[model samples]
Target chain A: MDVGPERNSLLAYARNWLVGLRSGELGVLPIIGGLLLTAVVFQSLNDNYLTPGNLVNLVSQGAAISTIAMGLVLVLLIGEIDLSVGYVSGVAAVILAQMLLPDGSDLPTGFALLAAVAAGMSIGALHGLLITKLKMPSFVVTLAGLLAWNGVVLMIIGSQGSIIIQDRAVVSLSGSYLTPDVAWAFFGILMVAYSISLVLARRNRMSRNLAVEPAALLLLRIVGLALVAGTVVSVANLSRGIPFVVVLITVLYVVLNYVLTNTRFGVWVYSIGGSIEAARRAGINTDRVRIYVFMIASSMAAIGGIILASRLRSVDSNVGGGSLLLYSIAAAVIGGTSLFGGRGSARSAILGALVIASIDNGLGLLGLGSGQKFTITGLVLLAAVAVDSLSRYGRIQAGRS
Target chain B: MTDAPLLELRGVSKNFGAVQALKDVDMTINPGEIVALVGDNGSGKSTLVKSVAGIHQVSSGAILLNGEPFAIRSPRDSADLGIQVVYQDLALADNLDVVENMFLGREQTNKLGKLDHNGMECRALEVLDQLAVTTIRSVRQPVASLSGGQRQSVAVSKAVMWSAKIVLLDEPTAALGVEQTRHVLDLVLRLGQQGLGVVLISHNLHDVFEVADRIVALRLGQKVAELDRRTATQTEVVEAITFGRVSSVPGQSGATTS
Candidate 1:
């Protein structure tokens, strides 16, 4: 056809843009285009929507969900799902609140945190053992866990109405902020460390005769990261400084992403999801990794529960029973992570959570009812699934052709 | 040459429920040699190799490594003794790159105990170079992206990288094109010359004739004959494997192979 050349050029441009997307980095085109679209639409609709305070509130509110989504990403990576994480978090928060009851009860705050983490881990281990050892499907086991944990929460909080967190340190964890100068100092230090690691990793790949990313690409990454760090610091400076919750979420994001991408455990997760037999042949203790993954997911839930309760200053029996589960899974999927597993990143969950929060915030500002919000979320979920399936089909077709 | 055979299996018998997969099979592999294991389907080639690689325990037999009796309690134990097996399907994770597949369970780690990608990748490249497998340009590329022959090369390299005393390659060229088969046969010879005892298991006589230094024939779970490559013809080895005995062959020994 006479239009073949034009079509070819369009395809070439698309290919180049696709190639630039990697884990932990947003493609520039989509990000820029999205920002422009948001500004155009929201700035015209509501004057207060794009203000710095609301933006700060958005980040703070999204952090807890994002942190929990990070853990859910791990569960999904190995081709498994933990339907109980939401309720587990709720139960964890309930327990934490109960521990701070009026009388001389339970352990200190630090010990209680550790104990909560342990409880979550044990529950996760139980799930793993049931799945692998008993040959029960994870979906079934986790589904049962979802109901069981919810029931436990109800039983624990029975007739007590709800418990409130009064500890100053615990409350400050979600509500407090750093001084402006200290926030900048910390941001600078983190950027330096990240840049150094990136450079060293690139060099290591080169030394191994592995294909190294182009110098320009690597430089672009460093500059991009520095800019992001600077932007975050400035945003915090605009508000009441960086919320301690943001700092906590950022630390978990960096550390957890590092473990998932650079470590053997991360590789094992993908390998198991891709092919369990292959992982076993490679001498990885798949059972152990599964157990460990569940533990990590549960522990994160415990941390999430604490933060959520601190933000609310109270926990009820039904705190995590409802839409939290769907939202967490949605966060993971919206961030472009695959549900079928062997593909995805922890960072995507954070990004996805932000996307979810944006939609929620935008709709709320527009005074949309819960039904309309649900419809929008459902449509987004369907769109994500469609994109995932199309891309997967494309890959398979490419391979076959 | 080493006075002791690198690996020796005596009366290795394995049973699966009611089926006698390998009934009293015996084989020996010396250092710096390529031994072809030829047999028909259900001829117990897999059973013999599996026993040697510790994937299955022999019901009754003595497996010796370097003239010392070895106990293979598990696959890890066999790997520790430098006995490696590369199966036909090549149990490699496609999502993982060549270096990751090669080092795999034995990935190199630095003092921090993290995956030493540099060390593993460097060692993998070196092993590929030693195998003379030049088809692949990037070791960082996932094994999924590789051609059939290249994947085979990576699998063979994984077995040979740790200085395996005996490397068992099962049907390395069975699924390959003619050109890939040639490349793989060359790799087999290269591995042998590198002083590792290589056992090439295949049904293709042409491939055996091309690279194997010796031929061991098995029929119906029993080793019937063993022939030196220089002394026996292709027809002679086939007859021995198919009929359980050599009717006419000049220089080959007549003793029971197992």
Candidate 2:
């Protein structure tokens, strides 16, 4: 064996691994491995668990929670919390349902959706303004919003208990699916476009003499993405089709994910979340960004409400309350985002939501009670937080050296 | 010489409710000079600097900037007039990279209106290079990952890059080690050499002797001495500043240079 070069490379790799471990980047491996192992175990427990139909159902159900979780992720990164998302969503649903009541309604379907989104955004902006301009803590402002918005929801619902959305167009939004052929075609187009963009971006960085990954690393990332895309498409082809919810989730993920990751707005979001004083000194209009962040959170929640109403065909006073809020926060946190702030991604919300949904799906199939599921979810959340805290401490200690 | 100073303060005082932090202080920094301001704790050195930085409003003062009558009501107002203050705390975000921290509030945008990171990184690298700062590794590295001296370097570069005609540094080398202190002192001299007025607040006489062209001493919010480097020795400057006179007479410290 060639001892010199091989031993040197091994030492280098070891050093890299140690650095990664300290930085929390290596933390993802164990989580991914655990998820894969869990999936295999569940699939063996019941063959149906791995079937295409159930998987599609699993992903579809995660879309709404994932969207709201994305917003919560932004808020949390800024070292703040919004406790009113559930009620804000419920109020938005109630308002939308009222607008959708057929006879000579003052607003059309598209206009009604826009109005509902605006109203949700306005409520969020109001909270942000009260906190930033009036110098109130966001926690208190959002808590007050929690009670106030729920009251508005109850008033909107009246004594009717439930308001059914008979609008066919709205129902079709989250319930229908594209044909199998169309789904495959669309998936093909997406894969090609994604690959091209990745390649072009790498090339641009290389030409500019900016630091980028080596060619081998870039190839590995592209190949990995290809495999994931191919697997998803194959599984979708085996099922009936791509559900409308999946398409909706994809659209939201792509748009918001890009805005959060690759743009100035994304940088501002992280900066504000990291340190308000630092961000302000950097010349960011912190006040404006704060108002906009809250607005986005409430608006996305409104969209989540629309999806909920579309799927359930009704809106009620108790639509979004305790459990939904808990699930949304859990989804963002369990996806590996930091609760202490300045670290997280929009993609983590989807992952966390999937994890939550998977547990719910698995436990329900095993005939477990709601209490059992709740206990299990709580345990998972605790474990995730523990991992995060431990790794952060490790990073700090390493940094001190 | 023109009758106008680069920055002038008259009767600048600040009160925190019942506590009198600063009382009727007067000072001046001329163009193309290094002025070292020194005092003991609670001796109103910080209050005077804060007033100049616009972090605190003076209860009473007539301040002038570049011979213009100016009232700095906020940090933004001070920044607009090219007044950069580097506090001992450094005011840097640890999680952000060097370039990000340097251009935190004043980032360059591209035609697409995105943060033109390429240009900013290039500019940040150039600025550091011009200052002959070779201690830092990568400009992309977060400030948290840097050494104490490196962070101070970046903070100084930020103040310098902002075109600050008058840079006020508060205990810039207090938290620094020996090597780091030397590096900062060298940077201060370079700033003065570039014809930028510098107001350095320090307790270290060695550092003051190494960089400052003149020393202005404050004792309890009152100007006690102004010693040019060529005209006075360290002992004489210290005696004049500390006791507010050169000799201790029977009744009072005699007002004469020993």
Candidate 3:
């Protein structure tokens, strides 16, 4: 193997993975440490914080915000933001509720869902058009959208405070769970597929004489994942089984991660985010890509809104009100997505959402109100950003090294 | 010298409002030739390159490619015509790796349309090997970490990767050290040997005279002089760049403004 002094050393690899001092990556240590730290603090306050049942409920609660944040990652990747996502999602939920109102159109659940996503897509397209064609700042355009879409929600849900969703399918979206047997089976399938791919990749590198992890280390990595997966499934069995909402969020993560890392469109999104001028010189249609990214952001927002409504079994003008939008954005940033663009992952959105949701979940158990929850969450967000900025400086120094 | 030129600019003029950036410019670049474009700052050297790259449509005249009239209305048209440019300040993204930057807009895709990473890596390796660029430690290393000369090499390699008939490099070695400058000069000569029309825009006369087959000078948006490198002296080229063949100026002292 063409192993340089630092390239093939298992110790170096592990250290780098932990701190990323020499690698430009944000690293896994801080994220894991933060999660564990949160667990410890909350568990001390309320013994229920670390329980299997509470943890499963946490995933269901985090799914919608995580999904919304995931969509925001696309926009963030290209160095933009969608302030209207919360309201866009709110509008979609209202539309879906109206479609499923039995006394009204009484549309099929699938069609109603499609319509919500479509509405989000159209709204995103509009935002893109105004931002690009009119040459308006995205901040202003999305800010206007935030207010305008909130108005749309209010107009649609006028007189009635909320549209209660009586449809079984819609309600089941957030409440449904996979049985223990099915959850375990799915976990098994995933582990098998994941292990095969990872093993084959290592073998491929070995064949090429590239530095690769030792077989023992590779096995350890696989075993580690297996343990985690086992714990999650076992916990789900202990609770009400694995929530389908969690599965949906995970599926979204997998799909988006693949798309961003492996597709032409995905590369362009990063390129545009990196430097629009450079991307333009490279013959990329920057405007078109930007528009599409916004569209994706909104479409995902629609899905998030649906999840929220499904959980509550209703939609109202206040669905996306208060700190939901800010929290969603916060979740993405806390998960490790950069605000300045050109760097982020779908994993960040979900992980960040999990962190945010945990704070809320833990606080609720202590009988704390939303005020305390918001204050703590806001402080956490600030700390995350401070670390991110510090890491950015470290990235620069690491690049020099 | 008997070969027909690959690119010809005839009386191409460009005006941005009342300010004329390029005026009545004429030039020719043939296969297996190196043309050095030299001038003071704002002397239409960049304007002419930008015009050819279709960043600014010529207000008048025509551009001929491969002896055929070619209309370049946008940068894409220029790229489609096998013309590539490595800009001075921003030819690459610092966050992306060499392979990603090299194949930014024109990524090779698989049957399912995902990035054909293996294919691209092989091709990238082949291209780097062809250029004899041994400085890069890994293709996966982000561009931000690369030395200035290494980044320049990747940018030039990107132009070569796309099968460009003509390559325009704007100040490729302005930020490099002496050794790096020598390396880039060698690469420019190598491009000429490979039968591509290479346009080297620079402020360094030593560099231009070292590799360029001919020097084209511009002054105040006009083509002032075209000289054969073998016959031309440094003074003559400098004079052409500053004075434009006019023995003396009527204005106070001979002010040479950038």
Candidate 4:
């Protein structure tokens, strides 16, 4: 339908779908297009919307929610949902805040962070136990988790309505920025790593007599990645350099992406999501895998919570409240991660979160109220899920999924 | 190859609360032999196979593997005992490729603990090619794209790839076409000829007669008869399955509980 010129051809693009849309392939283009559309609309309306300072702020704000959504991708992949992640993060923040209360017995930043993460893992393990061992529906268990964890947050944050984080190490995590030279060097290294990994993977497949992409295609891939990375770094260096939160999110994105795609545990997660009975028949420890997934989700929530507190320089009742949960979920869906599971990757979280943050940042620049932002964001989330369902149905109808 | 049976079930009985799903079912599967398990719907054929695959724990049974009693409390235990199963619905994840499905639980990893994708891809190709399952377009393509028979082949190939001592196929040809069924039957024969024990569970009498060396019939949670294919007729096997009438076949086990 998008028949254009050869140089900018949609027909060429459709033909080049290594995995086609009909097969329910989650292409990055659609989400990127949405982002571009938002940028154009917002920049035209407001002068400051697309400025470097604003863009850096947008990344920092979205980093926390994006990390949680990254974990949600795994949960969703295995056909489970964790409604408690937002509150789980809130609980994580409060724990860290209390541990660093400066009451003479206040622990150092490193130990406090570790303690918070452990708590997150334990909470996830508990949720997994309820779901797997008791044979309870994940929806019910996680719904209950949402309520109970929120109660935990409320109780923990009692008396004092908010706790200001005074530890320099804690506050500076999301507040700091990479120097301009470091940002450029970091981008260079990232591009090089990307290129090398692609080459190595292609070589690996080829050595096994499996099909490999052409050399030209591989080169083009590197070029594309370099272009994107270079543009972001250049723009970021124009402001107070790249935010530390951006670096943290990017590193995790790569690491988690690899974990989801290239490990035995990762394959098991996908299999369990695809078909639990089948995974069991295949002799996979489905319960163990489920448990691990929950733990990972909670740990990610803890990280997100810590990042948010660092960015704000304080922990409050709204650490994971308001649109945090909604944004985390919407980010995943908006980035083309299937709610039904067995699809999507870590990139979905990063891109989806960015898209969401961009919209929020753009609307705020136009003096939009929280009411309008919530409504628009909700509609966007709905649209994403609807699109996911339609594509899934198409794949099913085509007998390819 | 040897005198002793590779797998033997003695006085096996399984109960699901008030209902008895398998009652004192005794069976032997020797290497290089095809044992076709036959029964009408709800006749404990599935239950017996599932129990062997450790999907359900038997209430009372002595399952002997190479003359040693083994406990199969879970599918993992069954797998560790060199038992592989191609379930009735072909428990292959549609989202995964043939290589991935074949090595789902028992994935090969490199020294660094990352997946050895290259090694796995090679091995999957070797097994599929060894089975002569040439209908698949590509092993890299997800099983979802494969036809019913192709998916079935991948499932069967998965069982064989692991060098399983005994392969249990539950209704392998149920959803297949005529040609596909023949292909599966041929593969079953090949597996047995390759010195592996094959238990083919199906209700199709014709399919049973094609490649099975021995036919074991179940009716209402009990073994009605075990017949040698050389000596038993289709009518006799069907009668045993539908009505629990043990035939006067020469190699009949005479375990008629009814």
Give the best candidate by TM-score: 3
lDDT of each: 0.80, 0.80, 0.87, 0.87
Worst lDDT window (10 residues) for model 1 chain B? B246-255
RMSD versus native structure for model 4: 4.7
lDDT of candidate 2 over B205-245, digit per residue (tens): 88888889888887756667778877778897677556763
After the best TM-score superposition of candidate 2, give how far the Cα of residue A113 lies from its true spot, in angstroms.
1.8
Which 10 residues in a row give candidate 2 chain B its minimum summed lDDT?
B245-254
Cand. 3 Cα-lDDT: 0.87
- The per-candidate TM-score of the B chain, in the order shown, comes to 0.90, 0.90, 0.93, 0.92
Candidate 4 docking classification:
medium
**What DockQ score does model 3 reach against the true complex?**
0.52
| Model 1 bad stretches (over 4 Å) | A1-45, A104-107, A202-211, A398-401, B230-238, B245-258
Ranking by DockQ: 4, 3, 2, 1
Off by over 4 Å in 4: A1-19, A101-106, B5-30, B54-77, B220-233, B243-258
- Please write out the lDDT profile of model 3 over residues A1-401, one tens digit for every residue: 44454345666667756665545466555567778989999999999899989999898888889999999999999998889999999999999998888886657899999999999999999999998889898999999999999999999999988899999988999989999998988898888988997898777666665556666677778899899889989988998999888778778888898899999888888888777888888878889989999999999999999999999899877987777898899999998889988888898998899888888899899999989989998999999898778888878777632
TM-score of 1: 0.89
**Candidates 1 and 2, the one with greater DockQ:** 2
lDDT of 4 at B235: 90
Per-residue error for A4 in candidate 3, Å, reads 14
Task: Indicate the docking level reached by candidate 3.
Answer: medium
lDDT by residue for model 4 over A103-156, one digit each (tens)? 999688899999999999999999999999999988899889988988898899
